[model samples]
Target: MTRQRKTDAPRAPESPGGWDVRSEELVAEAAVSGAETAAGSGAVSGTEAPAVSGAGAGSRPTRRGAGDPVKALMHRHRELCERAVDPLEIAAGLEAHGVTDRTAARFRHRDVFALAEEMYARVPRGEEERGASMAPPSRRSPDLPAGWALFALLPGVACGLTVVGLELGGGRARFAVGLGGLLAVSVALRVALRFGPLRSPHQAAPATRAWVCFLLAYALLGDELLRAAVAGGPDEPWAPSLTAALGLSLAVAPGVWCARLFAVAARKRLALSKGLTEFSASVRPLLLGVVALYLCALWALLLAAGAVQGEPAPAGAGALGALLLLSALLSSYGFTRAPLLTLGAAGAVEAGSVASVFAARLPGCDWIAVPVEEAVQAWGPGAVPVIACGAAAAALLLHAARVLSRASAHADETP
Candidate 1:
């Protein structure tokens, strides 16, 4: 009945986006009322007012999958393999792609193995002729001068001089000669290590190897002189006793030096089997020639000195010379096989030799001591030390040979 009179239908306020103006006005009024309530509540609680958004609308966007670093690296690795790129070039590429040096270093071997396997698998059996195209460029090391091998003989000169000093000279002269010889050998070794034999990967620098051998010879001579000087001159009651103990203790010094030299040489040749073989082969003959020359020269120098000084040579001097010659030969053989281990073994032998000398000179051990003492006296005051040194050297050489042979066999077995 209230609508009985024909009235126009109620019309809603229109907006361009199909929203109504009346509804918008109501919503704005409600929002304003809520904001006022919130402000009042904050004031009562002494709290800061909440931040309001300045935007009329807002939206949140999620990140999409662009790439995986590791996957990208694998792809790059495959590409490099297909192209047969140099490993150095590939490494540069990896560095540019955000792979840090630390990461590359940590994964170096693994990455190399992976790359190698990838390259190996890429080779086609059908295209055998094309293999040459993929081969790494051949590189040859420059040929060094032939005279480089002779450089090792410089230390031999020191050895020869030291032998002359020990056998032909008086006590004070012997001591001075030994000290000078030791110093000379030391200097020669330092020079060889820095700029001579160790300068090459092949150990073909005969000069350095020769120097090492010469150093050994000089040490032997020096040890003899040191012991002889300590034992021969003074007649004090404590002199013999003190000499015996000192001789035994000091004997190990030369052995230790020998071991250190051998160890250093071995470390230098650690990964170079071919070079080691070539070096050892070339040096063995040179060493033999040098050793023989050294011995003959030692005897000649001694005879010449005795004649010059008008002094008779020590009793059994010629007979005992054989012991030294034999010892030198044995030692040379020992140093060839496995230098470090041989040297260590030689040290043990030297220690035993000193003990033997001590036991030989021990009072009340007549039966055991007498024969040993007689032999030692024939060799010269400190000559007994050389017996043990020689034995140690020979043993070490034999052991080294066995080890090297085994290593070669193992290498042959490996793929």
Candidate 2:
């Protein structure tokens, strides 16, 4: 990711004394909506919004008459409004909770921005901006420092050098070189996920991560090996696709960068917007632009792979790479559900196709492998991930549009 210029780096909004803006937001939402109170050491615990006590949410009485929706919202977010520096800050806060012009109409306001304006004016803040609130700085920097971009290259360079060593090494030396290459790739990937743009709060479980590992391993050996099985050739299945492995390894850099760009742009859009519809309008173009940039990067990398190897990559490798990059983006953004399932499904299909070709040698199951064998003869084994992962990536693109466009999707974002 390009380092955001210093001047463009987002400045933290000056907050009122007594409570952190984030803490206040959490407290207010809980007290008003969930009827729960937090007890803390500071003034934060004392300034909670009022709600029915010792009663279920169904039994709680409305705080305002049916005609005045503003009163209800104002009451619900009282703490947030009182702590806000400006109406725009309140507007951003509301929009983060899925509020919009349409919802605001019920409150008799022209838009969310207008509703926030009224709320800000109504709250009485005796001491608004004396200093930073009790909380430390918000964990919200979207920019990845240029140093990180440089660091992102470390893995690809190391992987490339190791691959060169593997190609040059012979006999017993090949094992050592391959082991070192795996180590280098692993450490570098950990760095990308640990601090750079690829990190997320909601890490997948180990069981889920098995699918990711399966996809990477399959990318390296699954295609060529499957073809050998289809032809009934005596080729070694363990003789991996070095170019495909390189493609997957080098992907870490651009994947981290694209995610960083998307996050920075999304945060900027969230702040400038007044309504959800306006924000969504802004998100669509940004999403497409980022995806286009990623595709270009992928194309360049694929070309580099072909040049280095002295042989062109399989046409289907492009589809596999796209699916892998999109899955990484989705995981980084906390939209893990679809990506995990897609990865698992794609890996399963590849493995199942291979199994079917072998299963045909069994008694009555000769026809079981016919479909796979014929398909391989018709389109090559690369068609498996090309079909499965290409479809998965398309489905994920749709999922990303629907969820990532929402401000709340990134509400819990960390630096």
Candidate 3:
């Protein structure tokens, strides 16, 4: 309030047309000052000022070129991304970016679809693309052959039925219906298994199964035969019936197994032929030695049986000699042709008959009362040793022949 001279504030400069020059100048100065500040802070460059208009200028806090913010942000982001994105960093970034809980949870769980979508969005416009339909289809099943399935069930059927039949019948009937049913089922199953659609005829031949069945039947039949033989007397009616059954079964068994062998030989013709040749070559000497021993044993046995009957040394020896010769001849013949196994089998049958006849005659001998006397009377106590030697020889010869036959058949099969 001292000397209050009306000192008007320094007036702003004037402009044409009575405009408020000071206000306009002030606005312009403020804009220039802002631009300088922005430039210093690196938000914009001077060259971009002319292109920005009223609204655009407001939108952009400072002048900038088209790619400026994007380039700068991309550089900054790349630097930040170079620092590994640990779980903690990811969580922090999510929080800082104000990401929703659901979106953040998806990121934390590493959802593959979310990741793919993010990658697709981040890629600069035009790049190679693919769709979900390109993925391969899933496989759900396996393949198997039909023959294996069929063959695998045969053993189960046979064993199951056999057990059931045994439990039900207990040998009351010669052939129980249940046992027969089981056998029938087994045969049917075997046939089906062998001849199933996927099996080869050569591999599934029914003759093999038939042979096995026959062997089993034959063994069963032999028990009946032995029973009949033990029980047989002039007055026994059942003995005759059992004897007949036994004879029939015994007669059939060898033939059936032989037939199966023959079928196998025929199927593998070349192999069998080769095997026969090789077998014959290897076994000739061994067979001769065996035959000689078998003859000696047979003669000794006959002499002992004759001595026990109070007969002369030469009485039964001739017949025994004939039996040995027959066996050797049959065995030799059978080796050349597989059917000969049957002939040899028949010879064995004849030998058994001869032994039985001698055994029946020996009971009335002079040495029947005393064991020592019997031993002496029966081939003079040398009968056992001689018989043992003969048996050993026969066994060796038979083994040699068998081996030779198998070898020859095998050799024939080779190329």
Give the candidate number with the greatest lDDT: 2
Clashes of each: 3, 0, 20
Per-residue lDDT value at 162 in model 2: 85
Query: Which prediction has the highest TM-score against the true structure?
Result: 2
Query: Per-residue lDDT for 111-202 in model 2, tens only?
Result: 87788878776665554352333231222445454578767777788889888999899878998999988898888877767678777667
Better of 1 and 2 by lDDT: 2
**What is the TM-score of each predicted model, taking all chains together?**
0.33, 0.77, 0.24
- Taken over the whole model, the C-alpha lDDT of each candidate is 0.37, 0.69, 0.33
Residue pairs clashing, model 2 = none
| Candidate 2 overall lDDT versus native | 0.69
Ranking by TM-score: 2, 1, 3
Q: How would you encode candidate 3's per-residue C-alpha lDDT over 1-415 as one tens digit per residue?
A: 5786764443322322222333233334334334323323445332222233333232222222322322222222333223322222222232333333333233332322232233233323212222321321111111124454444345445544543454466545535744575566556544543333212223322443343343333222322332333233224432112221222222222222222233234323322222223324444544355345544554454455344435444322223233223332333223323223333343343334323433443657423224423433554422322343234334534654554333222222110
lDDT value, candidate 1, whole model: 0.37
The CA root-mean-square deviation of candidate 2, after full C-alpha superposition on the true structure, stands at 13.5
Clashes of 2: 0
